[model samples]
Target: MLQLHPEQIAQRLDQLTELSVELGRGAAAGMLHGGDITPLLERIVLVAKDMTGADGGTLYRPSADGRSLEFHISINDSLGLRQGASAGVAIGVPGVALWQDDGAPNLGSVAAYAAHRRVSVNIDDVYQSGDFNFSGMRAFDGHYGYRSTSFLTVPMSDHEGELIGVLQLINAQDRETGLVKAFSATDQRFIEALAAQAAVALTNQLLLRQLEQLLESLVNLINIGIDEKSPYTGRHCQFVPELTMMLADAVHATTHGPMADFQLSENERKQLWLAGLLHDCGKITTPVHVVDKATKLETIYDRIHLVDTRFEVLLRDAEIAALKAQLASPAQADEITLALREQQALLREERDFLRHANIGGEGMSPADQERVRHIAQRRWTGPDGAERDFLDANELENLTIRFGTLTDAERKIINNHISVSIRMLEALPWPKHLQKVPEYAGGHHERMDGKGYPRGLTREQMSVPARLMAIADIFEALTACDRPYKKGKSLSESLRILGHFSLNGHIDPDLFDVFIRSKVYLAFAHKHMQPDQVDAVDEAAIPGYVP
Candidate 1:
């Protein structure tokens, strides 16, 4: 038995009081530091050593199957050693089994005994004690030329009495004698209290990590839903977030310019990543046809085919009229046949013109639009025998669209996706660290000059992350060959357009500069762009860009 003097007891009491305060402070700090359990576990072992004057300590976490106690943390002050989970080193050793091969509690190893019994086990000296197996300890001490002494093993449990881990401290040294001695009852009591606190902290951190993983999984699920709705959009949803992070890392590494001082904490990085994944989640509500309109005259199917049938009908009618004329004037058959061939040639030319117009482009000239209008006025007899304009009102409207495949109403539907995304993200009950997710996700579509949609927020009103996302979204879209409406632009072309956008306030100039200077787009292109699409770029020629 170990006895303590009155003065020693007073000193220990003071240490205990201070240690309690330290534990509380550490737990709070751990929660803010990305809720990592490693720091907390390290602190637990260190605190236990300080309180008991132990020369070494080990923290064991039970395996998921509840069959063994694995070494999670180990520290030895005498040997100047730190290893295991907290030290970023694997133990590379098997855990102590709680049950023997026969399926009964072994109760041989001291740490396993403590965990199995859910109680503290204080030993004066392992070599002299036959109560628990000490063969491994003897072998370890022999190899290191050290003597194994006192041990105070405590079972950590949460508030509900669930086993969290087992903490074992060895060789408690005398306060004044500088010699190892048995751990006293006072030492065991204090260590038990510390272990309880550690258990609660560890449990809380583990729960927080689980919750964060759950949130990430939910975000991915939304992205998968968007992918299922449109196969082209899933890659965009994936690439934007990665590119946003790449640009963010570039800005973070920069030591000059307006973004030199910017940096992201662990929590901030996670928040931005989540925002990126959810940016286009609202596209799930978009109609598939509107999202994938490949040609100007496309709806459920290309309306150009229907127009071909009408041309065929007109050709047959012309041939029939020419034949009737030839029969009416047999002497003038050659003249009538020549006129029929000319009329057929004219109809074929007009049909080819309409076919060329049906495939949409970046822009359609006014002359082409007028030609579509003229073609629509020509007469065509349907199977119902009713003569009507060659192209109906809807077909004419779709065909004469001055830009990409979508009409004005369909463009509105596409633009509404961002608004819908904002609503969906904002409606969620987010934690304090992630509350900015809605703003970041929603701001990607907004322009720097406040000409953007949904809220018209200017650059100053938005965060750096929002601006970063805006650049990522545009760059990905510009170089994306998977889109139905446009082929992926070459690197120089994409950069030229991006540079123009930077000058026009379509995106943040500072971020655009960082994006270009860091060559972030090149990395993305190598991974996502076609081999032919990745071309050499001339930096000086890029419009509105400094470098």
Candidate 2:
């Protein structure tokens, strides 16, 4: 036994009080910094060892199936051993089986027995004890030429009174002689209290992780709804977040540029990721027919089918006229035959032209649009026994759009999605780090010159994340094959277009420069673009980009 003088006992009381304060403060802090669960668990175990002046300690958590106690944290002061993800120094250490194959508690192991019994076990000397097995401890001591004794094992029961894990402290030392001694009654009591605090910290961390995972799953569900709504945009929801992270990582790593100081914390990275995943969530409300428009004459059905029917009507009328002329003047049959041939040829040519024009193209010339108008003016009979113009007003408007597919009305319907998206995002009560998610996701469509929709925020008003997403949106749009608008553009062409946007203030100039200079464009292209679309880019040819 180690006897303590009155002065030494007072000193020990002060140290124990300090340790209690430290444990309480740590538990309170753990709730906020639950993100550091692994590290926090390790710290708690080490702190327990410090409180008892133990030379070695370990902390274990229940395995996934609740069959065993897996080592989460391990430290040996005498052996200078540290292991776990938290400490970044891993060693091969087997887990403890809390229950035997026959469903019996593992009483042969101190840590396992403590966890199985949900109680604290204190032994003044393992070599002198017969109540429990300490054979493994003897083996460890034998190999190291050490006398392992003075064991303290406590079950870390959670608030719900379920044992989550166990903490084991070994080899309490004498204060004056630096020799191993019995763990005191005070040490056992203080350690049990520390174990309680550790349990709270661990529980808080686990709950926080579970909550974060649940949130991510919910975000993914939103994106899944959007993806199901528009097949063309499923890839958009997936790829944009990936590209956003890539560019953000580049920004984080850059130490010698205008964006060198622009770094994202882990929390900021997560926020941006969530924003990217939910960027087009409001598209769920968009009409699928308009979203998946594949042709100029497309609606519920392609109106070109109606147009084809009218051309057939004209062909029938011309054939009837030709037959009448042939029968009326058999002597000049050859002359009538030549005129009929010309009319048939002209009708066939016109019908074929309309069929070709129905497919959406990047641009429609004024002359071509005028030709469509003339075609619309030709007369045809309807099913109602009324003779109407060849094309309806809607049909003509869609055909003469001067660009891909959509008419003025349809374009407005498509453009209003941004407003709805902003409304949908702003409705949520967000936390501080995530308050900007709506802003970041909402600003991808915005222009740098204050010409953007919903809110005409200029370059200075947007965040770096917003600016990064803009480039991602444009580049992905230009290279995505899933869209109904046009074929995916080549990498060089896309970069050239992106460069033009930068010079014209359509996108953030600095971000575009970084996108080019850091080779982020190439990185994205290599991963997302089609093999043929991944063409070599000419850096000098790209306007607004310097060497």
Candidate 3:
């Protein structure tokens, strides 16, 4: 037996102590930031071979059904072999079967034996030992003119005492002569400690991955719930993500522009994409009645019908006046009928005019709005058994709205969605990758000059993603045909408005320029915009464009 003197043994022990410390630190780091199991698995085999002075090694993880031990990693300094996910190479070697076709544990192979028995298998020389099968190894040696010698196989068990995998090292070499030697007790013990750390690290990593997947699924479910509550909003949620990606992809693809230095890793892209999907998630708290408001006169229904009722009262009063004139002077009955007919015709025209006005439009002229006030000045009887003005105070305010359908109060309610959305997202404790989600989602409504809502972050304070979403939000709303209040603007009109916003410092100037140059507008037009809404956009006419 080869033995060391006391002084030599002390030196070896000290080296082993330092090696252990380094290996422990490496294992801990791999556990936390390995990125994938392949790296961690490759790490285990490489480190084990270094400590034991082994010429080659392999790591085997049990197949999903536990029917075979799949070779996850195979590395060898002597054979110049590297195979597995980490190397981006296909594992050419056939996997070792853990169980026979006859449903018996295949304990003939050394790695399988360690896995089946849950113990370590150490051999002085595989060529001499009559323990487990080495026929495959012998064949490998014959083909390569290499020696099949020492073997040490150790089973890796996790904290739950479940077998995670097996680690096998072969052909331990002499420290001085470079000759093959048997693996010693010290070498086997060191490998066993590494196997233990590997097993636990693998388990924790798998658990972390599973947890992240769960959280991602929950985010999707929340979006689905929002869609179910308001389909109009749901379409907006789905479309914004797609459009955001298109714009982001454009910036990424550009090589010689303002955004050339800007790019996103797969994870960063994922983070931005998710933020887009959840930009309006706070709309879940908004009242459905307010969100679906279709017209200036809409509540539970349009109040135009109430005005129709008042018109009927006036017509009834006119018919009564005609009958009274006929009774007072039968000879003048024909004159009274002609006069009443003219008055009745005027009332019908006025009623039709008011009905047309009630259906909200782009712009109400000052003269048209004044005409509505004139109509309101006429008298009618209320349902409360009292005489009142034809149009009530609320009706006057609604009819005379200078722009879109929403009154100031209703607009405030609609705007509160951003505040609510920020609240919902900020409440969650996000993982590192998703930490910017709330910021990105919340900043969609903010402006370049800090004239936005909830927080009103300035351009310098906002991320490119937030500014990009602001443009997306406005364009989507402008071109959306499914909204209750207004006609979808044609592509030209939408671009004109977007240009105005960009010039006014409502959105990022550079991103808007990139958007124009990249034809992101064209791509979105082809995908989502209706053909009618998609019209030719004049480049020169577009506001703020130097081209």
Candidate 4:
């Protein structure tokens, strides 16, 4: 045994007191910062090891079932043990102290004693029990190689008087002889303070976990709602993410390009993908009626049917006039019959011409052109039996429509959807990576030559991603088999049209070239374009578009 001076003892006590103060301060700081509890608990072990002069220590918390206490954190010789070791609540020496009460193997003994007394337990001897008989003491004693004369266990409780955890200290040094001895009352008090601080930190950590979970659930629900709104646009939310990732990957692989700043790390790539998926989330605000509109005359109430009804009235009037003329001049019936027949034939031709013109997908032919003129020139009697013009002269001569799906006004509203998309996206509280989504998605209709509607941004003003989306949108529309307005264009025809746009500066010439050369257009065509249309393209005849 080695003797220590009074000054040395005081110094040792001061060090132990300082350890408690530092542990409490650190735990409080961590709680304030919303940090995890594991670090605080580990700090407790570190302080315990330093103060008590032990090689290691473990912190235990009760499991959900409350049947056993589990090791929440452990510090062993500057090395931490992995969570959930085989040391059960009742298998180790610490567990014996944690589970014991009144010198016997009472399962609820430790909990009852702590609750009833509201005080910590300090066991100075394990081999010889003075008042507690822990059943697992022998197993605990053997595993730790403890010929211990003294041990201390402290119950840590929160301000609400809830048991947070337990702290155990082993082998205190004897003051008189400098020999190992059981932990004293002072040691118990020191550990109790540390345990209290740990409790506060743990509570704060649990609260943070709950908040994070709530946020995640909310984001997921919003994403699901965005994905389910459109029938034809189903899987679009998912596809955008995939395509964006692919583009990002390609950009990263390039050694020289304008995309150098856009090179993304793994996490940044994931964020980009997420942003792409949510880019059109604002489309939820768009009217579903407009989204599904398949024709120029489509609206909440169609007016094209009214035009058809008017044509039918003209046909009826022509027949009625023919009958009236024949009945009124029965003596001149042969001349009248021949004249009525010719007039009836002319009216029939005019009605047929109007019908075909209204349908409008076929290319205009000479016969169709002449028929249009005849319909425009034809006259009829009004409901009041007065002569009236069927169509105005200028309307008859200037009605050169190439498509039947959308009128000039309806097309403007449809094109203005991109602006609606922008406004809708601007309303969202997007993360940094997704901040550009509104810009990219809203510019899908913009052309390179500043002819596109809404912003009419020229090529330099738009992003490459926006350009890609524009091309994809056009290509999809051209070859889609499901549109009600027109037959799907053949792949050859679609590519030729895309090439024409590329030549005219409506689309990115380089990207269009890349799309063809990389066979990406063909791949998209195969997947979404009609199979018969896909077969129409001659690969050999198609010009190389990509450098």
Q: Whose TM-score is higher: candidate 3's or candidate 4's?
A: 3
Give the lDDT of residue 118 in candidate 1: 90
Worst 10 residues of 1 by lDDT: 28-37
Per-residue alpha-carbon lDDT of candidate 4 for residues 163-237, written as tens digits (9 for 90 to 100)? 667665556665446566666555665566666656665665565456545644654555577556565543555
Number of the top lDDT candidate:
1
lDDT for 240 in candidate 4 is 50
lDDT of 2 at 340: 81
Q: Using Cα atoms with residue i matched to residue i, what is each candidate's TM-score against the true structure?
A: 0.92, 0.90, 0.82, 0.59
- Cα lDDT of model 3 by residue, 1-547, tens digit: 4654567556555655665555455554543443355765787788788777899999998899888889888887888888885787878778888988898999899889999899999999888888778888888899888886888999998777777899999989887888989888877876787787677677776666677678668778878887787788888888887888888888788797677888876767767887898899888888876777788889878788988988998999899989998999999999999999999999999999888788778889999999999989998777787888889899999988878888888889989999998898999898786788898889998999889887878998988888788888888888888887777899888988999999998988788888888888888988898999999988789898767
Which 10 residues in a row give candidate 2 its minimum summed lDDT?
27-36
* Prediction 1 TM-score vs. true: 0.92
Candidate 4 accuracy as lDDT: 0.60
What local lDDT does model 2 show for residue 166? 87
Error of 3 at 413 (Å): 1.6
- Residue 3 of model 1 has an lDDT of 67
Q: Which prediction has more favorable lDDT, 2 or 4?
A: 2
Q: Give per-residue CA lDDT, model 2, range 1-547, as digits (tens).
A: 5455667557656765665566556544543454555655776777677666799888888899888888888888888878884668764667788888999888888888888778889898888889877776777788878778788888998788888888888889875687888788777877787777667766766676677678789888887887878878888989988998888888788887688788887778878888898888878888887888888898878888888888888888888988898899898889888988898888789888888778878788899889999988988777898999888898888888888888788888887877887888889877565688888889888999999776888989999998888889888988998787689999998988999999998998777777888899898888878899998888988999998
Global Cα lDDT for candidate 1: 0.87
- By TM-score, the candidates rank as 1, 2, 3, 4
Give me the displacement of residue 235 in model 4, in angstroms. Answer: 6.1
Report the C-alpha displacement of residue 477, candidate 2, in angstroms. Answer: 0.5
